[model samples]
Target: MFAFIISRLLQALPVMLTVALLSFAMFAYVGDPVAIMLGQDYTIAQRDQLVADLGLDQPFFVQFMKFVVNAAQGEFGLSYRLSRPVAQLIVERAPATLELALCAAILALAVGVPMGVYTGLYRNSWLSRFFLTFSLIGVSLPTFLIGILLILTFSVWLGWLPSFGRGDTVNIGGWSTGLLTWSGLKALILPSITLGLFQLTLIMRLVRAEMMEVLRTDYIKFARARGLTNRAVHFGHALKNTLVPVITITGLQLGAIIAFAIVTETVFQWPGMGLLFIQSVAVADIPVMSAYLLLIALMFVTINLIVDLLYYAVDPRLRIGRGKGAH
Candidate 1:
């Protein structure tokens, strides 16, 4: 397991470097951060000094190497727009994005898995058909549209939930969280649902399909032939196997939730990293943009590594295969 982890980390190194290089290259020339930062009143000498201070006058590779080294130490310089350290801004906004993503992932798994199980087990049932139809809506609608519709229904029309913001939060050792407050929880509902809806449908459909496929396998027939109860054969045997693929999809979808929460965040005006990134883009905040890019890439790599590790836990066959190969 240690070797596997080390190997995965080694694999991730190049990917991270590639992402860092690409992000730096792309954002480096996007706009005149000097002009944006110094404003119209600055003299040419001041501009030159600013450019020198920012290392803009250096060779491209030199600047890129500096960026990589700085980034390694969790420094992305200063945000041109916000005039704050990019890392600090990310730290402040990260909790909101992570919290929102966590809630969305929970909603997707909690609701999707059961719905999928029921649909797979009772494929001909009216409830199963209804779930299928509902899933279609969840899958078909765009995230922003869903968020807006939800805001209209729940926030505007029903007046049950707040439309925007992270609501009230309590800072615990510099980690701000809304989970402790009633208003915070309420505020989370619509955005969480909107962000998770597509993932929920995707998970449900994947689970249902996997479940159905697993149920038809010869092992399932053998289990039934052994006079196992329907519940035992279905849940104990088939569901366990069904979850192998579900775990993989769920892991990837969780990463997707964080990466693609931009649309939902925009619609709901959630004060998460996605919203921050959007705000930064208007002025071409390179530090924030590059940092966001690197962070997202890191998250994806980490999630993929975790998912690979989980395969050994979920599917014993992987462990057995590894053991055999070792021997």
Candidate 2:
């Protein structure tokens, strides 16, 4: 296990380097970042000063190396718009995004897995068909559209929830009492649901399919023949066997949650890295944007790595070669 992780770390170096190179080349080739920074008022001389000050006049290679090195040291340079340390800004805002993302993941698991279990257990029955149809609708809708619809229905029409933001501005972090807890949870519900819709749909389909297969296996029949209850035969034997694949789907979707976060953030006015990423692009805050990208990619790769390790632990047969299995 240790060797596997060390190998992954070594492989990650080149992947990350490629990401940096591509991001730098694309940003530099596509836009006049310095002029954007200068805005409309600056003359050619002023633009030159702005470019030089930001070290844009340096060779591209030198600039990229410098940026990469500084980013590794946790200095993501200064934000052009905020005039603050990019790392500091991200650190301050990270929790809000993390909280939102975690909530969405939980929501996906809670709703998706149970529905999937029901569908799988019932097979072609009305309950299964209803859940399958619901999952399809969830998957088909765009997240932004879903978010807006949620806002309209729950906030404007029903007047049950707030339209946007994390919660009350005054107690963004301080609210922990009974009433406030409910308020905070209420505010988060719609956004979390909006963020999780696609993932939930995907998980539902995966779980249902895997469980259907598991139920057909001889071991499940053996468990049933042993006079086990229907619930035990399904949830214990069948669902447990299905979990390895379910975990894989869940881990893969963890990466997707972050990817989808961009759209969801914009829709709900969530003060997450996704919004920061968008704002940075308009003016070309390279360091901030690159750092955000790198961090997200790391989250994705790291989750998959953890899943790989977990899979090995979950089923020892995974370690055996396919050639060995064929024999």
Candidate 3:
């Protein structure tokens, strides 16, 4: 297990390096970070001074190496716009994004898995068919549109929830979280639902399909023949077997929840990394944008690694096969 984890972490390094290099190249080639830093009012001498100060006048490779070294040490430099350390800014805002992502993932699993199992178990039933139809709709609609629709329905018309912001956070050890507060949970509901709906439908469909397949297997039939209760046969045996794929998909989607929260955050005005990223981009804050990209890529890599580990836990065959392969 330790070896596997080490290997996964090792494998992630080159991918992260490539991502950082490409992102830096994009910033360097596509736009002038120095000009963006100094407005048109700045004289040539002033611009030269600014460029020298920022090391923008250095060779591309040299600059990249310096940036890479600094990044390795957790120093992403200061934000050109806010004039604050990029790491500090991310730290302050990341918890909100993490909180939102976690809420959405939990919501998706809590609702999606059961509905999927039920629909799969009763594939021919009216309720199953109805859910399947709407699940398609959930997949088809855009995330931003869903967020807006949720806002309109729940916040504007019904007035049951707040429209935007994290709301009523409590400070715990330099971290402000809305999860513990009533106002925070209320503010959380609409955005979480909006973010999770597609994932819910996706999980439902996958679970339903997997369940249908598993139910037709010989083990399930034998369990049924052994006079096991329907609930035990279905939920205990079949649903448990179906969870491997469901977990894999759920992990992948959880990554997407964080990566693609840009739209949802924008629509709902949630003060997560996504919104911060948008605000940074508007003013050409290259440090923040680059840091955001690198951090998000690293996040995806970490989630995938965690999912790979989970595959070993849930499926003994994986552990045995890996053990044999290791020899």
Model 1 collision count? 0
- Residue-wise lDDT of candidate 2 within 263-283, one digit each (tens)? 888887877788888888887
Q: What is candidate 1's lDDT per residue for 40-147, written digit by digit as tens?
A: 898899999999998899999999999899999999978888889999999999999999999999999999999999999999999999999999999999999999
Residue 148, candidate 3: alpha-carbon lDDT:
88
* lDDT of candidate 3 over 1-327, digit per residue (tens): 888899899999999999899878766776677776676788989988988988888999999988889888878878888999999999999989989999999999999999999898887899999999999989999999998888899889999999999889998997889989999999999999889999999999999999999999999999999999998999899998998998889989999999989989999999999999999999878888888999989999999998998888888888887788755
lDDT head-to-head 1 vs 2, winner: 1
Rank the models by TM-score, top first: 1, 3, 2
RMSD of each: 1.7, 3.9, 1.9
Model 3, which residues run further than 4 Å from truth? Answer: 38-53
Clashes of 2: 0
Q: How close is candidate 1 to the true structure, as a TM-score?
A: 0.95
Error of 3 at 191 (Å): 0.3
lDDT of model number 1: 0.92
Q: Which pairs of residues collide in model 2?
A: none
Which regions of candidate 1 fall more than 4 Å away from where they truly are? 41-45, 324-327
Compared with the true structure, all predictions reach lDDT values of 0.92, 0.81, 0.90
RMSD of 1: 1.7
After superposition, candidate 2 runs with Cα above 4 Å error: 30-59, 169-180, 319-327
User: Of the candidates numbered 2 and 3, which has the greater TM-score value?
Assistant: 3
lDDT of 1 at 64: 90
